[model samples]
Target: MSTERFVIIGNGPAANEAATTLRQRAPQSGITVFGKETTRSYKPHLLPDVVAGRLDAEKIFASPEDYYNERDIQLRLGQKVVQVDFNKYQVILEHREVVSFDGLIIATGGKPRIPEPLEVFEDVMMTLKTTEDARLWIDRLARVDSVLMIGGDLTSLSLTRALINIGKKVFFIIDAESFWPLPFNERLHQEIHARLREKGVDVSSSRKIKRLTQLSDCSIQVETDCADFEVGIVGAFFGLVPDVRFLARSGLDIDRGILVDENLQTRFRNVFAAGDCAQVYNPVIRDYWVSIGYDNARTLGRIAALNMLGGMIAAQASPESIFSLNGVQVNTSWWMEF
Candidate 1:
């Protein structure tokens, strides 16, 4: 008899949780994790701290590189998986490297959703998701006096606060009529908006940024429904979508994200998914939405690992209520802007 091989994509929290769980259950399993970024697994939430210069890039990783080596887990970084040959039970990398597995887990997570209006000015635009993203824009962030950000979610607010912390003015533009994106009570929504405004954030709603023009010096001229404004840089928190383009033709069940059952198993038996990439059933929404909390990702990863090993553990971390606004509002009180 041969030991099983487990393969996971995206070395973020979800992937780490899944790998740790797999190691505990299947000790002899050949566990391998693939990360698109070269850095080791880190908490995505702390990227804002890094951008704000409060945390160092090296300190953000949840585990050091040697941890994986000590645990007998393989880490394949800097390789982007582009295709999956389900029949062959293998993942094909961008450069045509193949990784075969007996059980496959897709923890690929989400990518920054850059709006079309900001696409042309990509050089001047930023989406703070990865360590590399924060490092790339950190120097530019220092030279900027004011920053323009689009969206009214938690991630948006976190990034806004980070910019404000660095002595840079922040313009938080909410494209919708109301500032809140989630279906929270009107009182809470107003409360959050008020708090942001109180912090000296130039918060605006009901205006959509239509286009962005990058000047020679890398500043941005943004034209919106309300008016045109020039700013040092422009960013959008339109939220994240599953990085599942590689599976577009793979015939996987995908709606908003990779659809998984209670055990986080996809339509295919040998393949499962979790975290931002997996849209598990949300009892609150009555439909599957991406589970964004740390607990939710951890629970999903554990459940996915068990199911991968023929165990039937049900997922319990999908929130039953929408108390906080996109899980970003609660942290607003932790930091002071200006």
Candidate 2:
């Protein structure tokens, strides 16, 4: 076997799993993980549970520092990849250091999409992407009397429940016609709506926020299509786009995410992307999009590692899943077709 080094640029579950798999498959291959966060990769999808006080932050981590140490993979936390050079297969970090990799995997997760113009007032809102974001909300929750949450996704609904549990008045604004547009049907939406309202959350559907105005007192006035509502804080969890800026300039075919073939190979023969960042041809959906859940990330990571090690495996279909909150428990499970 060749002693080629593999580099993973991300701090999320995808990056962690891929690194672990690479170590197991190619013991001699030097594996290094570069993350923009301070802590080991944690499950970001469970950030709401952490905010809701249902889960401890430490328990949300897929693996700990000792786990990585046991695998002999180098860990570089709290580091951001500023730019990349595909021609040279090198990456530039915020610290002005250049790292080169023989095999590269871009597992960088998406950033929270704050609407245009409103992004100028970042202090009035928070986006839940990393542990820092979750911790910030935990500290702010006590100071805020009311929360204006924007989005109808599962994460937003869970955050609404958490805010209401803490006795903070909650107003949910959704631009969609229904809650959780893809996974839930009308019946399921009504069921969820009833449950949320019973918990004292005000749910507003088919509403769009025009702009966010910060008052002199630091309260936020959310101007919507229907009317204006004032609250102490605003949280948005619409969804995530693929984190592909580094790969964008690499000449790799990118659609929703970095495009890879059935073998998980990018246009560059030595590079492969997996997890939520890699868009592979889906047999069921008949298109490539970043796989959205943790299980998909795990499978894709293993697949990528195997492909990188020059192994052949059958491609499997991607599954659909949904996240739901049952009281204090956050249940994220596979969504089966009836």
Candidate 3:
């Protein structure tokens, strides 16, 4: 039996896929998955459905309760990896627990990017990045009749539709800057505004947010250059940034994310990064690109695992660029097949 110990840092699609692939290829390998979230991996795309009351919260889980146990995978939930010691081949948990590994797969995923103007008021800003965030929105929505959404993305669009479908008033400030990496042309921006207006959304053209004031009734007052509005909550959906703060000192080539070769292997051959947290090299472009979405994450995870096992399989470029949104073609990296 091979005694190779593998460490995967994440509990999302990429992390789970890597673990499964590793277990299959190396049956006797010691595999441990560290998830910051207490819950198991779940479909983040289905979160809007849960918030809209269309799907049950329990149905979001991507795997069965005993999936890891059946596969003999060590699953450590709620343990945030604070740092990685590449030289020592060790990972330090938040509580300073150190675990050594022969192979390491980093699939830390992305975190919600809060707009610069609203950074100070992040405490009151609602974001839908995980199941927990969705549950919080669901609970908060029950008490309010209207919501103010700042910024726009595929997730934001879906959540807006969900909110409207549930008979809640939505005031949207369409920020083109939120759709980074996605070509947000003026024509497309205007089209989004038109579509949102057609869907009964109070679409505001203003992009500048002056201030946010918390009201005594547990509501928020948004002051924009165009108008002032008060709502139960302010949702920020400015896309995502790599959640690689923990690896800041790991000495991995870091741009917006950890840079990896076409084989998903870092400069250190034993280390690999995949999913949203990895900026992979695109041979065609001769540049690095960060691929998002569930499909891309799963594909990259599998490729990363294969390369970790001494296979030289290059990752393909993400094929998800444009998706139809209610008859409108929207360009985004966050598109899900579902």
Candidate closest to the true structure, highest TM-score: 3
Q: What lDDT would each prediction earn against the true structure?
A: 0.76, 0.72, 0.86
Instruction: Report the C-alpha lDDT of model 3 over 63-157, residue by residue, as the tens digit.
Output: 99999999999999999999999889999999999999999999998999986667998988889988889889998998999998888877888
Worst 10 residues of 2 by lDDT: 322-331
List runs of model 2 lying over 4 Å from the truth.
115-123, 177-191, 216-218, 283-286, 318-338
Residue-pair clashes per candidate: 0, 0, 0
TM-score of each model, in listed order: 0.88, 0.86, 0.94
Choose 2 or 3, whichever is better by TM-score: 3
lDDT of 2 by residue, 227-305 (tens): 9878888887665567887666668888767887766778886788777677676555555544666776777777877
- Per-residue lDDT tens digits for candidate 1, residues 1-338, read 02798889888878898999888878888998888899898887888889889998888888876989988899989988899888888999999989888899998877877656556656667777888888867877767788888765557778777877888888887654223325445675577668779889888766776777877454788888889989987876776667888898887888767888767888887799988788776554455555665556667778888888888776654343432444431111112232
Q: Which stretches of candidate 1 lie above 4 Å from their native place?
A: 116-123, 177-181, 184-189, 282-286, 317-319, 322-338
By TM-score, how accurate is candidate 3? 0.94
